[model samples]
Target: MLYIFDLGNVIVDIDFNRVLGAWSDLSRVPLASLKQSFTMGEAFCQHERGELTDEAFAEALCQQMALPLSYEQFSHGWQAIFVGLRPEVIAIMHRLREQGHRVVVLSNTNRLHTTFWPEEYPEIRGAADKIYLSQDLGMRKPEARIYQHVLQAEGFSPDETRFFDDNADNIAGAERLGIPGILVKDKTTVPDYFAKRLC
Candidate 1:
């Protein structure tokens, strides 16, 4: 069996509020205002799809959000979104691999976000046999083609593959391809959930 995991929230604990908090301190924008105004628009999607460079995305974000900060400040606040790594999930994945299952990552993320996780959670990135990044893949999740690309490229059987993600839409997308998806509903319980079954 193959276990495909998502990077954010699933493997690495993340919260956009963390980013907003850091940005609010730097920009003097209230957290509520920042949260309300910040949008994951085309610029963000384009960044994840590797069309927009990090500098371009940051500039676009600052302009759209009316954030009063320099590029350095914006980059610093952006990195704050990552909270920590899921050690339990990583361990379970390793154990599953030891038990003969293939483990891989399929993440919808950008280059700016990439710089942080690897430094913070080296083990999480190394745990996977293959790490598929949206920026590198030129596509993002909930898109049928990305899922199709990974499955076909790996020659994985949909019946034997399980995708773990935190988003409902991503799960639906995988299901459309006949790939079973497990939603990481409660991050705390994810370790136990995998430990019991796959390993």
Candidate 2:
């Protein structure tokens, strides 16, 4: 069976609210207002798709709040969004690969985050047999076309592919395509999940 993993949240932990809270102090804007604009402006999506540079995105965000912020402060807040990978999750990936499974990463990430990916997970550069970055693919999760792209590129049948993602919508999309997918809740239970399915 082929295994596909989602990067953010599933592999790495992220807290947008934490960054937003910090930004709130700098922007003097209500948290609710900032969040509403962020979602409405699709700033997150733009950032993820590489449509907006980090400085440009931050400038937009600050302008939306009518607040002034230097790019450095914005970057500091943005960088605080991601937490590290859980060792158990990393171990699970390694174990699956050691067993000869075709393990790969299918992540939706912006250039800003990816610039620091190697430093964050140095072992991952050559570890995963294959990787699909959404920015480069011009596609993101919950999109059927991206799933098709992944399956086609890997030359794997949908039924034979097992995808693990943290987003329910993405998992649902994969399921609709005949790919078995599980929402990764706890990293420790992954071994059991894989064993039951692959055995």
Q: Pick the candidate with the highest lDDT.
A: 1
Name the regions of candidate 1 deviating beyond 4 angstroms: none
Q: In candidate 1, what are the lDDT values of residues 93-138, reduced to their tens digit?
A: 8888898888999999989888888888889767888899999999
Q: Model 1 TM-score? A: 0.96
> Each candidate's lDDT (Cα)?
0.88, 0.78
Please, what are the lDDT tens digits per residue for candidate 2 over residues 1-199? 6889888777777778887877778767787886776653577677766677878887877787665678877777777778777665677778778888888999978777776766878766555788898778877777899999989888899988999888888899899999999897765556667566543
The segments of candidate 2 whose C-alpha lies over 4 angstroms from its true place after superposition are: 28-37, 188-192, 195-199
Residue 128 CA displacement from its true place in model 1, Å: 0.9
Clash pairs detected, candidate 2: none
